[model samples]
Target chain A: MTSDRLAPQRVPIALGDRSYEILIGSGLLSLDGAWAGLPASADALIVTNTTVAPLYGAALAERLQARHRRVLTVALPDGEVHKDWTTLNRIFDALLEAGCDRKTVLYALGGGVVGDMTGFAAACYMRGVPFVQLPTTLLAQVDSSVGGKTAINHPLGKNMIGAFYQPARVLCDLDLLSTLPRRELSAGLAEIIKYGPIADPAFLDWLEASLDDLLALDVAALSHAVRRSCEIKAWVVGQDEREAGLRAILNFGHTFGHAIEAGLGYGAWLHGEAVGCGMVLAAELSARLGLIDRALVDRLRALIARAGLPVQAPRLGIHRWLELMRVDKKAEGGEIRFVLLDGLGRATMRPAPDALVAEAIEAHTAPS
Target chain B: MTSDRLAPQRVPIALGDRSYEILIGSGLLSLDGAWAGLPASADALIVTNTTVAPLYGAALAERLQARHRRVLTVALPDGEVHKDWTTLNRIFDALLEAGCDRKTVLYALGGGVVGDMTGFAAACYMRGVPFVQLPTTLLAQVDSSVGGKTAINHPLGKNMIGAFYQPARVLCDLDLLSTLPRRELSAGLAEIIKYGPIADPAFLDWLEASLDDLLALDVAALSHAVRRSCEIKAWVVGQDEREAGLRAILNFGHTFGHAIEAGLGYGAWLHGEAVGCGMVLAAELSARLGLIDRALVDRLRALIARAGLPVQAPRLGIHRWLELMRVDKKAEGGEIRFVLLDGLGRATMRPAPDALVAEAIEAHTAPS
Candidate 1:
């Protein structure tokens, strides 16, 4: 609404009283005035990883200083491997050591790993506290940072222990993505592409055409990509905040995606890459179930490859895939529930027969 | 209202779709029908403690197994001393080791420590899972189990880390009180006495009249005590489930009570014992603030003493008391917020003058 082209794009997620907004734009991390809308908090804890903190922590802290009483920065070790109980406790230790009370606000200022851990920390710090998501990666900006799914990985599974806690606000600075590595961008593109088959067909088509610009870090294309992905996720989260029914659809390929993450040991593959490959397996299973046609599967596969994501999943043994999938949060009664596309822009959750899923996995696994 | 006095009293906590009922009465633990309303799940995780498991774990498991395909029992170490992240993680470890899926139900079968840890475990397990409160201690039956404030103690504070996760149902069996040590019974009396000044003055009179029968575990007197306490707590929780405002009133004595526990190194003073003494201090503060008369404070003190609870707060030095209280869950923005009495049966939260609190502490500190 602010006709200033330099102004951020704002998307609202309506959850009644607990609603929040996702602000997408360029150079938000440096915009001091952008934080004016945050809840009146006396102190702020800026949580980021080693890599992102050195790059953006000071800038974000400087901007937040105008609003918060005190701004403290704690840079956790960089990457998904460090997302565990030990790392999570460090945040608690810092907050307690600093005498931050229940009303303190936490700022998550890095990628998905940092975002997820910070959000969970905020959720549990004093039973619950407010948090802001200042996501610095495409994957976090478009996916993890938007949904309010906060968790730390357990040795048995990824995000096995977590909370369905929402953030007070999400500031997605598209400029942050400019510093991201090429592979991580591709990884993020997988999540952006996720919106198409699950909720927005037009976004899917736009992604098909804008893949090159987005990969090249074109600002306009990247902004639109992050904006549209957030819109889809916001709508899904708004309707089903707790993933009771419709919300599970937004987790289109996450069930299989999580298995891949766990099977390979967390952080072996970036979350978005596992999801990218997971999406392919889901589409193939949908095709096998006669839920979707071969052309649609091929369309998704082609776009996935064009976006520089893995079109073929790892050759995890059938039993291993089954074992990992059974451990998913989406699962119920020991049955692995999956979100399958009824058609483009439509998703449904149901238990696919193990036999059919195994067949699809065998066909999709990369040849040894 | 089943005329068969043996039938349990059912109190419903109306949280719309997430609403649940609390069933209270004698010998309900042995009744097969008591667990019929629990969510239909293939597996159930019975989380008890070393103390309570020997007495009631097998009986509860037998009834649950009739409805669940598998019943797994995990008895954590007994006592408040074991209520920490280490013990809380044990519940998670057991759930994962059992391959318990999201649909699995958890039964917390013990006192306040077991119920708090188990409910928190359910809240964090795979984002969240359903749990039932099988409170065996009178303290839990009348207080912690009825409300959804589940948490474990942080070394820095009591109940510093946890979630407000409601259980599917709470079953309070008065029969279990038969085995309670006299000291534990007195600990529970503190919680019973709490409802008097904070919410129900009439209940205080009732407790005064029935203290002798209640101490002897008279079935009728015990049933009434549990039923009315749950009613008061349920009404409070129904209005303010998350302690946004009105709920803070429930912690009238807790600000100091928690300090007492943390100062004494948890388990040294039973939670209710700490609160018993805390209520006396809060009442004295109320009288000093001109909200209530001297007689009110004396009445509360006499009842607390008659219940065999400590009426004197540990001096712990004025600075130490303030330091411990600053870390309380109810504290916000680094200010120690205490739940104080506006008058009998009415509560308000505010900060007491440090000098006034210091004077009260000096007056109440037991000779050492």
Candidate 2:
């Protein structure tokens, strides 16, 4: 066991009356002290999935059982595509059979899929049970774990059904990423890179320089990236946890990326893969609008390509893209809002014309 | 239409951190101004049940349409038994098909069942969307509407699955209750009587005295009961919205009542009816503990009986009662926490021994 001297830190997300904390650190899974911050009770259910159970479920259950008199674990099928109401109902069924109560705390262990499912389950279980996020994937650690966005993908649209439920604590154990596949690690980096253009320019520079070290899986590089990304997300989430205003900036590439994910079907493309390509397209769109220099857009695309991510959108055609983007959560009335870059680090939401979007799609699919 | 000036008043639930308002009155739903308080640029989905759609869904959609560019309504199956993940998914499916955005506001228009399902749906939709409660039942008006306890019943338990997502505005339309069935009206009174012993003693006495007028559906008496009950609930919820400490007092009869509801099966008895009987049993448990005068327990039973609710425990037998009670949300670490009265209007939670609980059940159900 690692030394327990390093204390976990909590980032307070201020939503006026709905503020909560995002706990950040490693080895948090073994800490009973972290559980104290949750709603005081002994009855809790740890909602994980098949992929995460072998790695962390037993240890987590043991820790919870040490502190709590009765601890139960419910493992579901693991996959991004499996994050749906039918899968969520399995959790409800377990909770009901266990006679779980309002005070019961649900621990979400695994990557984004498990965390998303657990948060959604907690949000609906008995109306709502307090849940803590034990994010085990890099994507979950740097991005999904911090924001209160919890949801399941609909067949028609990815993340179409969901809620903004802030977890009581977000336990990000960097050690968990040791087992993550290489593709997943790269996917998680896409979101880490996203925080740069959308919020912090300095972080972007750091990421650009540390790309090799991060890919090499250096602990310091990974920690710095994860911490900085969390800080940016924490600040944005704190300002607009419900995405009423500033939070929209976090979706810099998500509008286009979600369409790609939905267009190809949920599991066909990893979320971060689509996001990486979508960010490049969004930068191109920004350059066309004269919001950013074309050189900078090329540089952004080059970096994404160097990192082994796609820089061009899938060949869905412009019309399908328009239809898909229309169903985005960012769409208002009938108008679709796009979060475009104002500069290297600043992004703003604006409505774009159909002709420009069509041209961008044509360019994206025009043989690279 | 009644004067728009007579819109519902907001009662701010003043928790140090998660404080919010409970909007009470009539015609509040018809006002477009209320929608402005929600998150910007999001679509709006109104979730009502079959019973409430024809009554007020269109009016609500019309009001929201004035401020929102897109507003959609989904009507779910009515009744407590139907409030599950399956029905909840119907709203999720509709939102996805309609391309509802992340900022979409879900309006819950109905009684507790509608409010719970809509709130839970909102909590899960896009992770969560801002939701407002348009409570239309007497019971919901005073109790469920004010508290953010959103959930659906499981086959094994009454409110086995749920979340604690607060509504942006709880629009209590008293006029809608006029169409509620007489049985529902009577069932609601059981909760009305709950406020007295848990928090306010004078309120209990007032309820006992005004029982006839309230039962007769006198508008003034109904208004007073609804308003006062909300006040008590708002105060309790304000202190502990998640039932941490002060809110446990509000569950004076819920521990045993939930068991009865689950044992008899959900929808078999109106929630209020089971609660009424459970209150009698809780009072008896209090007497067994020598915590309260037996006469007061009998008085509590009489009041519940006069309100046309069952006061005697059903013949599910002691073993079944224990099994059901074990599943109560109040049970922590496998120990039953009973909210027993020290006196009429004063309650506290303590672990009751199963032997004593069995003895109390025998005392309450023995042929006498």
Candidate 3:
């Protein structure tokens, strides 16, 4: 609630009683306000990935200790490869072994992979328990952390198995992103850039102008980027929590992005990286469909490349790409549905002709 | 819609948009009305257990063919033992391999295990697809099928992992119960008897009078029993879909029932049998707490025994039972909450002293 320019920014996601606030600021993790109002529990389990555990697991657990009588931490193996039933079971096993009840609160303390698995574990553990999101990566902070879309990847598809379970709160501590690898930082930017073209043209302009500051982990720029991204996502999710319509627009690049992640095997490229590359191809398709002009398509592609995302998709072969996209959750009746840009700042879900889709893939496929 | 006394009866579960109807009658599976209004999908997957698949899988698939362009059937390993992540994953594999879209409809064509697993599969597949319940067992028709409580058993507890995803519709075809084995039939009767003490004293009187007719598979007796059970369950669930309060009453025997199943290793005893024994213990505990008289406890015990269910609880050791009940979803903050009968036709969730619970167990324990 602080209005100080340097204070943490709070963006509330309106989901009725399930509604929660996202706190974005530098070092918010150590602040009491960040932990306030979360569902109280006798036991709190911190579900984080191995990569982020050593860095902040203890610190996060320390803050939670003040709220919960007993605080436990389980560090899952790092990466998208482990986002499966096996990895998910580990969380369940920990909760059960510790005798954690439905009242136990789970804290997802890593990037998208950790957040997704933890959220899903919370959703299924004893038919769901409350959970909080402590997103440490840029992509998670801006996109995955805001929406209630929690899932683990199946062998056939990325995020093929999951639930629409919302977290109790999300704390996107900007200071945590200081440790993010250069590659992952750019990947996070890809999602930050996604919000601009699909929902806010002005935000897209802001991202383009502030990409450098974000890359440098500048606190103010990171705060604005994370807060604005959450606001846009929150607005869309509020309208369609189940993705029956408006919420699907938030997945503008995900259909293509998922195909790439699945086709290459998950963890080959980070999820954000895949989405970044996929956004380029999605823009190409939008241009070919005459939904958006070529100039806009090139503009999106240029921004994606400048953000250090690959503009060229891996050569998965045209048929494989089509086959993969058809299996994307967006597809209906076996027909692949793409979230195409109707114009700058507006998105729509529709099917493109296979020939045209193939052409778009061919236009952007990396050479053999 | 038919007014004929012999016609199918519909009990609509009022869960807003997620609301669906339970059609109970003779030969409901073959009737077009039962299949009508279900979400249309290009592909339909019939998930059944090996035992039920041979008897009803093809017939159910055939009925669904009229609605779906393609019909697929998967026969899982039979029994509660198979309701685990591995068996659940088989459903996901079938959907992914068939290239099923999010719009695909899954039909659960077996008993409680099949229905629970299928509903859970539908809930998780591509983040949920519509599923219809063709519950064949009496326990399933009256309890599991009516409420949307779908789950798979974990090694630590019964139904430890699951979701509260409702089915598109539930078909409790009374004719299917004709082939049900005597033990399972008895098991199913346990759930039907459950509705009486917790919600309707009159229904309990009717069950006591009609137990023989229900056991003999008298169409009229079975129809009335199944319909009343669904009505009571639907009423309870409609008010508390997430078991925040009233819905926990439906799990009257389940807390102790689950302990028996887990103690014996899931498949050693049928879920309903365990519940039957558990109800006797629950009633004993209720009597010990003076919530109900010894006469009422004996009345419920005698009915459960006459229905061919075990009234004597298994020797799991009192401490083990206490430990298992603490992990039950109803338990909060490590305190075990039992759904006890305050009086005939009234259920209340309250914590009882450990001494009383142990005494209740001691009173009902079978000779080792």
Candidate 4:
């Protein structure tokens, strides 16, 4: 690969006043520019997880020490199960114990769970403080960390408690992804695939052509995939920060996906894995509703399975599936709204009849 | 009192798109205008304490039923002690159980404790939902409800976890104040007394003359007091929604006040009572620093005492006091910053020497 292909790329999130940049590159943790122009404060708190801390925590603290008088670290237990009030409170305790002020900056240094809890902590601590995201996992770097959607899951639903508070900046160091597990890499690829169907058909074509290279951790291919995914997400979030309308399209598969996560309980399935399977179900529902053809559903399901994601739906009972989807944030007045593909490269949110939804679920379910 | 004085006075908070009006009147809970034009939603949740639910819950539920298909009430155990994660979660449980959607509107139907927690719950649930403040106590009607400052106390400090989320509107029903305990009226008068020293001397002068009428719960005097307090707060918050610079002046006694609340444990002293005493100590510090003379300090202290608020500060050891102030949101880099008066009707935030702060504490503190 050319050196230029490995160089850092910057994507700007165009939110007025809260606008910030997502810097995607290799070896950003060591770069001085990544640490420059951050909020000037006496203290900086690094919030990460047990899984990712040992790998990169010390390096991040060393770089931050130059910018802040005190740099403290709080490594929470890894996994989505810990993404609750008890774990979130740990971040608050760390900040208050350290006497971190409102101006103190928080660095979120793990995957989605770490980024989420850290961001929510920053959002609530002293009513709000500046925070930067150092997203390491592919799913986080490509999707979750780029958007300002920060939250912790409640027992009833995933991401039920959160805020639309943007980060000061997002540093996506591709180098950190090197240590990520093989399954997580595939899980993250699911999100990259999602962008293609919902927003860009050309990107979908590229993904089909380059899926193997991306799977092999090809630097050039991974760079294009991440940059493109962030650009689409940043563009969508810019238009709808609070998910008033256009933003709903970003959750093309999340309605079913969140159901899987909540029904089986979070941590049983990685978020991206569930989203991957959920996308298949959503595409099926779209076809059943005549929004798209059956051919499109088959094509999407094939790609998800090829990417090492499950296309077969879980055996959550029909009534249970319907119940869980009803609590999805997109649901309104007890009606489950799915983000259906209007056509390839576009999406719309609407409700389908229960029988139709049940058929879609039944069509995709694995024989139990 | 004239009938015109009973008419609702609307004090608009100009926070761009988030702005809303604060309706100050005698019988606002029963008024049609108070419940009109709220966010059209399928559900409305009235979050109040046990104390308020018995009194105003049915009245509010009746008014809200006209606008919402589902009107749900969640009565939390009363008191500041319940302002924690457990209490905030009860609101979420009710919302999720009742299938409250993103468009759901929350009505905070009590005093500062209820307003703070309900506003925070709105700021969090499903990212954010609209909430209206039905502030019943004088303290909430005059200060807490108008500023968009919502929080729950952390174990380490008071209001340590929260958000700067504004309400859709604030309804200050003076009729509700008739049931307020004699001590609670004086507690609220402390906040009213605060606006004079920090922003308007004329209002302070008017308060001095009308203190008796307010103490007696005179409707005309109470209406004017609530309306004026809201207007001044609205003006300050409009300029600085977040407490960056100018907004710090609004916490003239809060640094000391928060220390007292946290030092004694939060429910020990009513928030306004602690603030009432905090103002006395803050004034003493200002005087010792030569910002104001001893006479001004004595004048303010006498007013607080006459209002039935304690002028003598709680004796939380001097070291513990400093430690608590250091954790205040205003503190930066472990240095305690106090909002001190430059002269009558104006305030500035600055750090005082430990000796001077200790001396001020000694002068006003109750003898152990």
Q: Per-prediction DockQ, in order?
A: 0.67, 0.56, 0.69, 0.81
Candidate 1 pairs with clashing backbones: none
* Candidate 1's TM-score: 0.91
Task: Kindly list the per-residue Cα lDDT of model 2 for residues A142-230, writing each as its tens digit.
Answer: 88767777877777766666676778777777667878888888889899899888888888788889999878766667777888888
- Clash pairs, candidate 4, are none
Q: What fraction of the reference structure's interface contacts does model 1 contain? A: 0.64
Q: Would you estimate the TM-scores of all the predictions?
A: 0.91, 0.84, 0.90, 0.91
Candidate 2 lDDT: 0.79
TM-score of the second chain in candidate 2: 0.88
Between candidates 3 and 4, the TM-score winner? 4
The C-alpha RMSD in Å for every predicted model, in order, reads 3.5, 4.7, 3.7, 3.1
Cα lDDT of model 2 by residue, B1-368, tens digit: 22334545556766543455666565556555555566554478888988889988888888777767888888998876688768878998898787666667888888888888888777767666678787888888887867678777666765666677777767666667768887888789999998888778898899889999877766557767887888888877777766668788888788888888888877788888888888988988899899999898888888899999988787788888898887676777678899999877788899888888888777777483
Q: Encode model 3's per-residue lDDT on B1-368: one tens digit a residue.
A: 12234788888888777888888888777787777777887899999988988898778877777888999999999877799999999999998888887888999988888999999999988788999888888888887876677899888766889998999988888888878889999998999898899999999999999999888888888888988988888788778778777778988988999889878986788889999998998999999999999999999999999999999988888889999888666777689999899999999889999999999999998666
lDDT of each model, Cα atoms only?
Answer: 0.85, 0.79, 0.87, 0.89
lDDT tens per residue, model 4, A1-368: 22334667889888889889888887788887876787989999999998888999999999888899999999999988899999999999998887777789999999998999999999999999999999989999898756688999888867899998989999998888889898999899999999999999999989989988888877778888999999999889877777789988888898999999888987788888999999999999999998988888888898898899988889999999999998676777688888999989999989999999999999999778
lDDT of candidate 2 at residue A266, scale 0 to 100: 71
Model 3 C-alpha lDDT per residue in residues A8-62, reported as the tens digit of each score: 8989888777888888897687777777778997999999988899999888888
Error of 2 at B90 (Å): 2.2
